[model samples]
Target chain A: MSSFAPPVQRLITELGRLPGIGGRTAQRLAFHLLRASEEDALALAEAIKEVKARIGLCEVCFNLSDGPRCRICSDERRDAGLVCVVEEPSDIIPIERTHEFHGRYHVLGGALSPIDGIDPEDLRIAELYTRVTPPADAPQDEHPTPIREVVLATNPTTTGEATALHIAAHLREQAPQVTVTRLASGLPVGADLEYADELTLGRALSGRRALS
Target chain B: MSSFAPPVQRLITELGRLPGIGGRTAQRLAFHLLRASEEDALALAEAIKEVKARIGLCEVCFNLSDGPRCRICSDERRDAGLVCVVEEPSDIIPIERTHEFHGRYHVLGGALSPIDGIDPEDLRIAELYTRVTPPADAPQDEHPTPIREVVLATNPTTTGEATALHIAAHLREQAPQVTVTRLASGLPVGADLEYADELTLGRALSGRRALS
Candidate 1:
């Protein structure tokens, strides 16, 4: 026999399709929505609709935005000469939380994975090249500063490393003046170095700098 | 500065209110929704709206339903004379899944919790009594069978046990003819006897029935 009403079953099915949510979690969420006031449930619906309707990729950095440019790209105080490249818009959150990078960002949408059939053409690599290149139409005063450094802040995974190296090579050939750097890796803060993997330990040893 | 746009932040805030969902998970869900196709996202939204708009409590059993009577209550084949009382509508699912219960259900909405100020008046106990009692107005052919048994299937938690005891006591005083029973408690099937808790093992020893 059918368990729940059609609407409830449909809601559960839709909710279950999310990345981490499962059948039980979807049911819990659906029930929560049922228990919530109309204003609250409708607000979530409206937010979903509004995000899709209004938000789009920034023209400059391809980060999520409500207009042509994302907030960071539009801000004049941010260093225009520095750019941080990441895999997805979500990655920008942790970097921003660090308060270390004062530059803008480039969202690749995803990292290169040959086994998964993803390649440089699948991402916004051409746009990155264009952004790094000096705009021919704009007057010198309009575009005063050229990007001097591009930080490859992609994940530490194999695909991320490959994508960064590939991008760095292209940038070196096309824009030789720009400097490329990757985030430092070491035993995580509060972690016991005894449990650190061999690859990470090897990288830590080689990249070690003079103690302050 | 705001990490996300207004709509994005609002969606994250709303999603974060769900049980077990943290701020990061909420942001992840919001981003997934943003990336989902319009049809997929709108379908979820519409389902949420439809469940709230159409569904209400079952008049007879207090289970969630689209009309006055729930599906089980409306079905003529179900054993209405045998009622299984439970704490919430969701509790009915596992019982149904077992395929052992062909009887109808009565949802209590919640168990008795004196600390939380829950009492008999707060639940549908009166309605259950009304169901058990022979209706004065119904014709002989229309309402032939009076409720014969009430299975106290509330959760085995403290409040659930108290609610079941309270209901059993009231039923004995008011409708002594009706049989009252509680679900058997013991070591779960496939569980190691050595690992079974003392209380459960003790109950199993005391309530052991003769092997066929």
Candidate 2:
């Protein structure tokens, strides 16, 4: 049998699973939880549960949302025609923080990683194709809502690079009317979007170079 | 109004309350939680609540416990007479991992942080004193348990050092018969026990030096 009680062991195990926490750090966190006031401890617990219960993926953009559409997608002021495509929901934050993009976004869920068996089908590529292309039937209304441009904002990593290329090429064939562009090379050659500083990312947005 | 949806904002606000997590990290974690599988998200949530529900302070030694006494204090094999005094429950893990000590522990809650107004009374110092000194009256049916040496294994920080000094001095007056020794100087002078590597902590445990 182990020296620590079951609750202590459980706390340590759960804490160790977090991104940066190690065995020692987990133990410290476990002890901190042990010492915390009942209300405070339960507050953290309720927060986790509440987040899980209420928060969900945005149907339009695949970012976090409480309802079907995220705040960005639901906003009438947002430019729907100019959709910026990226790999993950977390990527949306750095872009949002920069205040550079007035357009809405489309999260691909993940980049195309053939080595990982994540091909074009694994992402929301089909949805992106539909979002840009003119509707199958002509609109009964006075004017059809046409998508004008799509910025391929996937990360600069190997997978992110390949995904952008695949999306751009596919969009050219599927939706020739829409202008397709890729983010510029201001991103450090091989860094993930998660790690890039805001200034570099903002510059990349402003100085975005075309893939075509 | 802020751009983020209410659920996203709520999660970010709650995450920011953690010890080291800032606004950006909180936002990232919140989004990560949103993307996480319902099972994974609920697992972390239940773990937090379950820990608080099941865990409590060890009355005997002040380490975390599910019941009246912690696993260490309740274990029959552990030498209760040879108690290891530590600044916090986290300190107990390194000592256990070393496998050098086979004794129970008395968690001091925290070291004396005068700037923060944390004194000896703020910790379980009086309780530690009581444990070291047995009651005068002996039970007729049972042989009285003998409480012997106390290992003052507080951290090596300025606050930790001061706490150790205060404990040693108090123990001298309260329980003159008991031997109170501090862990060896192999520990770097100004560091907390949490940062010390296992090998160094192990060496320090074995080479424990007696206080003057």
Candidate 3:
């Protein structure tokens, strides 16, 4: 028989299902909740329920949202003509933290990985194309401000690179007027040159900029 | 304004309150939950609620239990006369895993820490004494099997040492017939002598037994 009671074992099982949590961590967390005040423990439970009940994907950008559209999609202040495409909703936060992108975002849901069975059709790539391209029935002037540029801000991983290239090629054929760009790849700031990986060093050498 | 919606922010805040979880980890967990299926997410929330609602301290030994008495306390086969005293309910798991002790346990709830205002009164030390010492009003034959021995299985920390010493003194005065002992302090089973700390090495030397 298990040392812990049924309920404790159940809680540990559920907590262990989380992405990074292991069995020991789940046990520790369960014990902590048991020791915590009723109000505090219930707060964590209520928060989990509330997030699940209220949060959904944005209709337009596919970013996580509390309503039909995400905050960025609803905001008129952000540049609608410039779209930064990322692999997931979580990717938008870091870019937002920088205050570097004044434009909206397009969450692909996930990157392409053939070995993992994730393909172009599996992602929200078609939805992205539709968002960028105007309808055939609509007049040229009907949509005054068309998407001018697309910044592929997918992760620098192999899958992210493949997904970005696939989308960029499709966008070129679908919307010839739109400009496609990729985020700069080089050694990170504050990094020692000696410790830089061969691939990163090569990218840094090839993409080196001239002194102003 | 917060970058995330109210529910997402609330979840992150609650997760951040957990031990070792920081803001970034909290955010990562919140995002992971958001991405998870509704059933999977609800299971975690329900688990938290169930653990809080169903689990309570064992009435007899003070270990976490789903009922009045914990598993160890309820077991007839275990040695009730031999008690192992620990600081918290969490400590019981490791001892149970070792399978070296067949004795029942007494959870003190916490250790003695004068700086933190924790004293004998704050713990279940008095309850332990009550369990060890039979009532004066009871006849000798009324309680056939009296407590015979107590093993102070508290941590090796300063507070734990003080708590064990205090309990030993009280047990000696109140129930002189019972044998009281503390867990030995020394180098761990699989440790190397070169990396051993001075205090631990000294304890190993002092506690060494004669080679047969």
- Candidate 3: regions farther than 4 A off: A138-144, B137-144
Error of 2 at A148 (Å): 0.4
For each candidate, the DockQ is 0.67, 0.58, 0.82
Candidate 1: which stretches are off by over 4 Å? A138-142, B138-144
- Sort by lDDT, top down from the best: 3, 1, 2
- Candidate 2 error regions (>4 Å): A138-144, A187-212, B1-3, B137-143, B187-212
The better candidate by DockQ, 1 or 3, is 3
**List of chain B TM-scores, one per candidate:** 0.95, 0.82, 0.95
* Candidate 3 lDDT over residue span B76-191, tens digit each: 88998999999988898899999999989999999999999997899999889878986788677634568899999999999999999999999999899999999999999899
Interface RMSD for all numbered candidates = 1.2, 1.7, 0.9
- lDDT string, candidate 2, A1-212, tens digits: 37677866877787677666688767776667767787777777677788778877788678777788888987878888799998987788788888888888999999998889998888998888867774667464412356788999999878988999998898888888889988776677788999999877887888886899
- B1-212 per-residue lDDT for model 1 (tens digits): 36587878888998898878998899999889888888887787778778878888888888888888888988888998899999888888889989899889899989999899998999989888888875688667645568899999999889999999999999999999999999998889998998999988998898899989
Error (Å) of candidate 3 at residue A24 is: 1.6
Q: Which of candidates 2 and 3 is the stronger one according to lDDT?
A: 3
- lDDT, candidates in the order shown: 0.87, 0.80, 0.90
Q: Give the per-residue lDDT digits (tens) of candidate 2, residues B1-212.
A: 24577766776787677767788777777777777777777777677788888877888888877898788877888886798999877788789988999988999988999899997789999888877774557453222356688999998778988999998998898888899898776677787899999877887898886899
- CAPRI rating of model 3: high
Error of 3 at A212 (Å): 2.6
Candidate topping DockQ = 3
Roughly what TM-score does model 3 have, to 2 decimal places? 0.96
Looking at model 1 chain B, which ten-residue stretch has the lowest summed lDDT? B134-143
Worst 10 residues of 3 chain B by lDDT: B137-146
- What value does the lDDT take at residue B121 in candidate 2? 84
